[model samples]
Target: MAENMFLFWGSGSIPCWKPMIVLEEKGFGGYKNKFITFSNKEHKGEDVLKLNPRGQVPTFKDGDIVVNESNAICEYLECTYKDKGTQLIPTDKAKRARVLQRMHEAAANMQQKLVLDLLYYFFQTKEEDRKEEEVAKKVEAAIEELDRWEAYLGETKAFVAGPDFSMADVWFYPIIAQSIRMGLDLGKFPNMKAYYDKVTARPSVQKSWPPHWKEEPPMISPFKGRI
Candidate 1:
């Protein structure tokens, strides 16, 4: 019997969405999912704060073991469930090194540059908000990074890790999807545009995306007036 697993998540957070995608790929459908509402400050409540002192969403509980941090949760899932299907982290030294390198890059570099910047522009509505000029610079920098990813895709096969959809791709696809939702023109990077369409079409990707997401307006950038 599978252990009772649960995930505490927030609906609008890309970090939470990352693990949701991984769980779908792992083919574990019987686990429970509980939403921690950001609007209500539910994540800061005692129960959630115990699991993650930072009170962030995307926390996981497997039986008695608790894990926080999106990337760490992904690594745990892949290791604990190694007998299940594909190994998310390759055992080969060279491939595994590349995988770890890329995963860190995506989380540290691309995510902050693209996803967080767009989040501020689209979600935060404070009057003291920073000027659009700063936002544009960040967006442009993110675009340059996307071009680098496109170049990598052109040189590789299969997915980000080559020949298989590993955790790197799992980590990557959601950020890209969020970028699309924020109205970034993916078409500017033809390879990435194609890759985006390809990943979202996967059965796992389809399963993880919330129903409300479908009804929301397609991500468009107010900067460009179109995504």
Candidate 2:
């Protein structure tokens, strides 16, 4: 049953990493995959477009079923492979709610601010057209998002949702890493820094760590050293 799974993924993308970590956690580490290069715009190709209309990586398949969004793929894998490996979505009602909240929060709140407003804004906007006031606010917005997580982790103690490592950690880990890679200083957020360090050492995360990141991370981030 597990053998039919396939993933189209690009290195260093948070969206791509979410499902890859889920696959590894579900003990499907050797599942078939094709590395789609973002630089080459391979994700926009016809093959990926067939499965995902937006032509995104982390276009995941399990036999006849296709799950395109990263969070959706993680949920599908958890619901399908509940017994194959770690149980990510806890059965407890209260815990399950918290897990779900954090999972989506990583995307809705965290990614929106960090990727879209901050880094993507920095990269996409032309230098001459850049306005110092708007850029400063975006940077601060990213910092405020981190402040939210820092406080959340401080309360949760071990992982994003609770003490147990669950689907929430699977969702949040990559975004946290992306923040750091973009030159967001972790020194100001102790709790988030601890969470980052702890998740960094997890086998599921380590084994699926983006290949390009290991070889060469960008020396310069779009942050312009502000983060």
In candidate 1, which residue ranges exceed 4 Å CA deviation? 1-3, 125-130, 218-227
lDDT, candidate 2, 1-227, per-residue tens: 65898999999988889889989988999889899998899999999999998988889889998989887888888998888888999999999999999988987888898888877876787878788899888888887888888898999878989999999888788887876787777888899888899999999999999899888967447664686
Q: Report per-prediction Cα RMSD to one decimal.
A: 2.5, 1.6
TM-score of 2: 0.94
lDDT of each: 0.76, 0.86
What TM-scores do the predictions have? 0.88, 0.94
> So what's the TM-score on candidate 1?
0.88
Worst 10 residues of 1 by lDDT: 218-227
